[model samples]
Target chain A: MTVSIVVVSHSENIADGAAELAAQMAPDVLVLTAGGTADGRIGTSLEKVLAALDHAAGGDGTVILTDLGSAVMTAESALEFAEDPAGVLLADAPLVEGLVAASVAAQGGADVQAVKRAAEAVRGPSQNSGPPPQREVSEGSVTGQGPDFTGDFELINQAGMHARPAAKIAGGLSALDAEVTVNGVDGASMTALMTLAAGKGSVLHVEARGVDAERAVNYVGGLVQAGFGEP
Target chain B: MVLDVNWAVKWLTLCAQAMAEHRVELIELDRAIGDSDHGENMDRGFQAVLDKLAEAPPATPGAALKLAAMTLMSKVGGAAGPLYGTAFLRAAGTMGDAAEIDPAGWAAAVSAARDGIVARGKAEPGDKTMVDAWAPAADAAKAAADTGGPEVLSVLVAAAEAAEAGAVATDPLVARKGRASYLGERSAGHRDPGAASSALILRAAVGAAA
Candidate 1:
């Protein structure tokens, strides 16, 4: 279980969403996204960013990808901040591109350098490659009825439950006339839990209720695994 | 009373020696969560500073501080580099022109150093890092300055004690921010590297004054 932390000025969704789109087939590796404007909780704290890099290493070396200047400065600081400066690698490759590539390469059991190449491959030519992102799920679709509502699905999005996703998740629940409570979380607040740290690979419960419960559970569970980005 | 020429040399030597020792410890603690270069980087950076400050015709205390800041920034890498660099720069800014600093001037320099850290770090007390030690130590230095004591060492002792206490207080904290916070549960076991180095810096500062 190796993890890499990628940061961009734009929403992390594009990369994670891209990964989720690709995962329609891959389905094995988990790429975690945290910190960005898309997630309001994110800020340019070199110290905080370094913490994420150290965590990802898991004893093996961890590769870090950051967007532009301050992000680069923050990244450089992380290189200096780690216990074995050699253990934390600051990628010369683009963040989203690198992450998109690493997501697949890592799953294929490629070496760290292979993952780095994957990242470089995805670096959208001169950036500005796609539209910001369309909605992931609509309300009518989320509330589609089938069976009894039993479980909950969590938003494992890195930026926390910020406006877009929260609204998508909440509106779906609202249309269903279901009694939904976001648990193991601050209940639709900005501090949506991203780490999933029951020590990673652990089960976390996000509660939703009423008529739409069944679909919400499956969708949210799927979303958490997809790293919560639009397909 | 007053520091003799030997006393001045002792202060400079003490600051460099303590920084070298603390930088290594800082790296060990940082290994739990951070990049772990605080010790090697600062030690390397400050040694460069000492080389420059040994300039011919030597400088006044304020000029010496400014030279130190420039050397650290140019030589060191990481958050500590810029922040410490700014601290000495600010301390020099506050020094004006003085052959020797009285207790009040020392307090002013400490305050300037604190301001530099706050500005560079943008961190509050609970961030589980350097600010925790720096903020209280600055307060203690200011309070001691008001004592009107004949010995400047009184202010030095007061500030150093406060920083040391602040560093110890970090032991049980679940760090909410900074590199250590990524450890989550793992970060809890060690003392904060930043706080420890901060205490050492203050101890060195006081030792120089004493």
Candidate 2:
């Protein structure tokens, strides 16, 4: 069983360092890195990264970790080139976490499919708290959280919480003293979970478990179904 | 005989050539369901890889390849850089300082490359990606190689063709993986960028072998 890693970051130092670290720890583990030369350097296109990753995985599957934003896209693109990409996963998990996952996945007789599923579980985006309360995902591998939640409100508008509705929700949430955590649906981060980039008929989980949990959750919920502010 | 430093260089050159040729078409496909840079990114990366191969010609297949991998990860941007880089590097590792490759050695090297791609990408046969092309291509190439058919040529051609067809097959897929997932139902109509490039690489393989 072989293991490989792909790290994408705009920072050349980061990309180089990370690649070095991965190589040091897992010398046998194939590592391929691609990115700009500096801080302001533009990262490579996600498409090219995908091809490179295919080379890494050979024919089995691979584990990928990204710096931010389209880094995930780049990882996803790599999966496209893999043979059993199901074994491929984007390590949102700490670098160590991803390495451990890859090792275990490789040893456990886990095909790229199993690795892909488990890794995706970690890479899967979080949900957001919003008007509609439901979220849909291909599978339930997504995990992790960012920040906390605050309050809620019954949605009261006709059009519901679209971008236009965001001002009210943001304003209401912003007004609260407490920091709010909004999940899109099914405990995923709709805030930017990649999967939730969709528009219209979207539902948000919208958790407000912090100091103003009840109030914030309710406020956001209300703003969601209520169509922001439009009559 | 399988291949040597010359074989390795030639094979990789072919890969770069294939990727360069098909890079655009792949990017167009990606634009529909993905980030739309597959072609352009790969083109940029392979061009860099070719440059590196020229600057420091490796004496052994393995040494030459490690350098290629380094170039991809460093010079190329986006996903293709790391992925293809890893494949070549890993395949080089399998070659293990070989002066030249015998049939089995070549098979092992290509298999290693395949393994590297699998480890890095983690894609499967169906998700409308290059896996569809790679899996069959690898199998077909190996079968052909054992028969004393053109080892490098058979493998590359098989891998490329299988990969391309696999990309086209993606047209009907709903994309269970990658940025295409963001497109959801909207992604179904397009072929996968990775798969398209996979085909081009196969074409290069055939070209190189001949």
Candidate 3:
């Protein structure tokens, strides 16, 4: 079974809509929504969140995405009262983007922690002001000290690097033991990959490091060559 | 007056009464810097607490507080729901199966409640949040409890007074947490609805004993 997801939002529409959007990308994963109060108010309810957590307890694990400050508090309060709090985690990421990334990761069979990371990774460098300087990779560095694997593949899909393709590559790569980058952006970040705006026929330069480096490079290459299974 | 299950029940009943009486005032306070639902949420939450208490009366003070915690968290539809719910839950945890609370036990329970609010909201004292009232009240209860006497009324009064003062103190401070923080400097010159409600709840404890 895959990891489950819970979306908490002040507005019922937001929670339901977010879960619905995420489900489209990861139909196999369970995405639950605990939004609004029991009396049909525009705020979150701990009871609803706790009930959602109870339902999600049957899965491998549960990750929560909250919309606002009080929604976060309500989710935490639910965890405090949950029967199995340890198996559930709260991801500090934007609701819609994080839910989508987390659902994709869970669909790809990533474990709980990896799923959380995939969700958080959506907040890439641009969002994090003054990110730590990256380790420089000189041009034409092909030695053992350089990247374990690297490849360039031209996008052939009519949709190019869209949400689905980015999600697919990011989701699959998140489960691997590698640090991969596509066009200088974090490869495991769907938002980062999509930021490239790499259209049809635009080449994608991939770099990888770690034990799954070769697998990571081949994974992206295969998806690109297949046009991400799209027209 | 013994701080027992009866006292707990009375305290919660008074809290519900106070919420109903001060609902509009709280709504106006919240409207200035928050979403303007604190009064309605707290009133509904405590009403639910009353219903639960009547349906299944708890045997101990802790059990009563625990029931309130669950009820408030479920019925209150705003940030106050979780914040106050967690405070009551942690306080209940401290009380455990005990039927009555001594002065020291009361102090510890209040402290536990404050810590839970801090842990859940991640707010510190002077953040223009409920923690402002809770922190000082915890401190006052602890001090009063340590006075080497069994004056339970004094301890309750001390907490209530300190909490009231804390609520007043929020009137001049710009909010550093919660939705009010969005207003930045504009949040000052207004009382924090959470702090105001916290004071009212603590004051109700005194009324229960009196």
Candidate 4:
């Protein structure tokens, strides 16, 4: 069973919309929304949060992403009062981005803690920042203790390294047992990849290590070569 | 008079009345630095507490407070919901299965409630939040209980008076937490809506005892 996600927001649309977007990226992950009050107002409801937790109880685990001040408080209160709070984790991350990252991680069979880490790691850098720290080994096979596989591929898609392509690459890489970095950012992080801001024809240097290292390299190569199923 | 389940219910009812009466003033206070929904949210939450009380009559003071806690958390629909809900829930936890609360027990309950607010809101006394009122009220209750005299009315009165003074004390300080904190220095000069409501609630407790 994969880890599940719960989105808590003051506005029903925000919670549901974020959940929907995350679900689209991670079809296998269970994304639940506990938004708005019982009377359908723009406020969180403890009953809704409790009910969502109950529904997600039997899963591997549940990670909650909340929006705004009171939503965090409400989610914490629900956890405090929950019958079995052991498997539930509340992530202190932005609602939409955190939910999507958590969902992708959950979809890739990450454990509850890893899923939370994925969500929280989204906050490492805001939308515009320098490239994230990457474990850059070298360009080629070093004295043999190096990446299992490495490759260089040019972006063929007109849009280049955008959100959808980044999600596809990150989602696929996360499922592998390999650690991969492209252009000096965590390859398993969608937002991190988007921050690369690589335009069309920009060459991407990929390095990977682990059992699925070859597959990870080939995965990025194939996706980039195919233009990420785009025109 | 021993504080029992009936007194608990009446205290909650009086809290509702007070919230309804001061709704506009709270709205104005919040309008100055907050989102301006504290009054409406509290009134609606306590109204839900009243409905829940009617639906399921609690057997003891703790049960009543627990019921109110759950209801307020569910119905308030704002930060106040969780804040007040936690306060009531912690107080209920301290009361345990006791059917009647002695003066010392009442003092302990108020202190627990204050702790709950601090833990939930992460606000200190000078933060211009409900903790301002709750902290002094809890201290006053404890002091009154420690005096070792007839304490039923004195404990409630002491708490109410301290809470009122604490609420007033928030007027000149810049908000250090909550939505008002976003206003920075501009948040000064306005009484905190949460502190004001807290004083009103403690005052209602006195009315119930009287």
DockQ of each: 0.02, 0.15, 0.84, 0.83
| Between candidates 2 and 3, the lDDT winner | 3
Clashing pairs in 4: none
List ranges where model 3 is wrong by over 4 Å.
A125-144
Which is the better candidate, 1 or 4, if ranked by lDDT? 4
| Model 4: lDDT of residue B170 | 96
- On residues A81-125, what C-alpha lDDT tens digit does candidate 3 reach at each position? 789988899988999999999999899888887788778777875
Over the full model, what C-alpha lDDT does candidate 4 score relative to the true structure?
Answer: 0.90
Interface RMSD for all numbered candidates: 10.0, 6.2, 0.7, 0.7
The model with the greater TM-score, 2 or 3, is 3
TM-score of each: 0.49, 0.52, 0.94, 0.90
Residue B160 miss distance in model 1 (angstroms)? 0.8
Model 1 per-residue lDDT tens digits across residues B1-210:
553333444555676788786766778877766667667766776777678766632457777776676666545555565567667778877876677777888788888988887776677886777788888988999999897586788888888899899888887777766666777777776778778877887787767655
Model 4 regions lying over 4 Å from their true place: A125-149, A209-214
Q: What does fnat come to for each candidate?
A: 0.00, 0.20, 1.00, 0.94
User: lDDT of model 2 at residue A170?
Assistant: 43
Model 3 TM-score is: 0.94
Sort candidate 4 into its docking category.
high
Task: For candidate 3, write residues B1-210 as lDDT tens digits.
Answer: 899999999999999999999999999999999999999999999999999999999999999999999888889989898889999999999999997899999899999999999999999999999999999999999999998598799999999999999999999999999999999999999999999999999999999999
Which numbered prediction scores highest in lDDT against the true structure? 3
Write the residue-wise lDDT of candidate 1 on A118-214 in tens digits. Answer: 4553433345344522323434454435324445444354554443444344323323433334555422221132222332234446565445456
